[model samples]
Target: MIEQDRALYRPLWTVSFDEAVTLVRAGIAAAMRHQVKDLLVDTTALRGFPSPGTFQRFLMAVEWAEEASGRIRLAMVALGEMIHAQKFGVTVAFNRGLVNNVFTTELEALAWLDVEPGKGSPTRRQ
Candidate 1:
């Protein structure tokens, strides 16, 4: 399941990657439709880490499907502290043309997204 939250005026995606490929593809498509440049993704409910091949495929999908004109920054909050390092490695390795970071908490992820160069606050807290 995937849910989009615009609570803080930013598009935060809380996605369960049980069906990794399908949910991920759908999320990307939805982001494009919403013209989301800086997206926070919560992937803490995934059953398991994606294999190398699957990650590669996802990377390719992003390169091919995303717009060519603008930068897309993604801050992904992983499942847990133990898996955070491993997931961060995957993100670094496959982050072709995107600014992707893995975090253990939403606060950290949001902070990272806020400081990205040229990316001002699209969302504000009440």
Candidate 2:
């Protein structure tokens, strides 16, 4: 996890279902604890595993972070193949009243979050 000028960036590298949920939840928790309102979750590594249950895992994580996540603008980064062309997790989260979006790259995610890379402290606060 990398904290920068306007948001916290979490790059998930081939994480399993449980790890993904835990890490994303942790990221949301950290943002809330620090009073930061933006979060970037890069899951571009999750590609080519076509599973309908994947969305359920995301739903679980999102529900677990319901209280804290609603206050944060969450930006997810994933490859086009990984992202469901329809019924994407981002849209579901948005419909549930969370401020969030998904993009194809970190650059797009950062831009969506209005995060100016290298413009602020890149250190994570304990």
Off by over 4 Å in 2: 1-5, 12-14, 45-58, 64-69, 115-126
Best by lDDT: 2
TM-score between candidate 2 and the true structure: 0.68
lDDT, model 2, position 57: 43
Residue 24 displacement (Å), model 2:
0.5
Candidate 2 C-alpha error for residue 4, in Å: 7.0
Q: After superposition, how far is residue 118 of candidate 1 from its true place, in Å?
A: 6.4
Estimate, for each residue in 1-89, the C-alpha lDDT of model 2 and write its tens digit. Answer: 44653465555466566666666677777777777777777766553334437657467436634855467777777667655655356
Please report how far candidate 2 places residue 73 from its true position, in Å: 0.3
Which run of 10 residues does model 1 get worst, by summed lDDT? Answer: 1-10
TM-score for each prediction? 0.54, 0.68
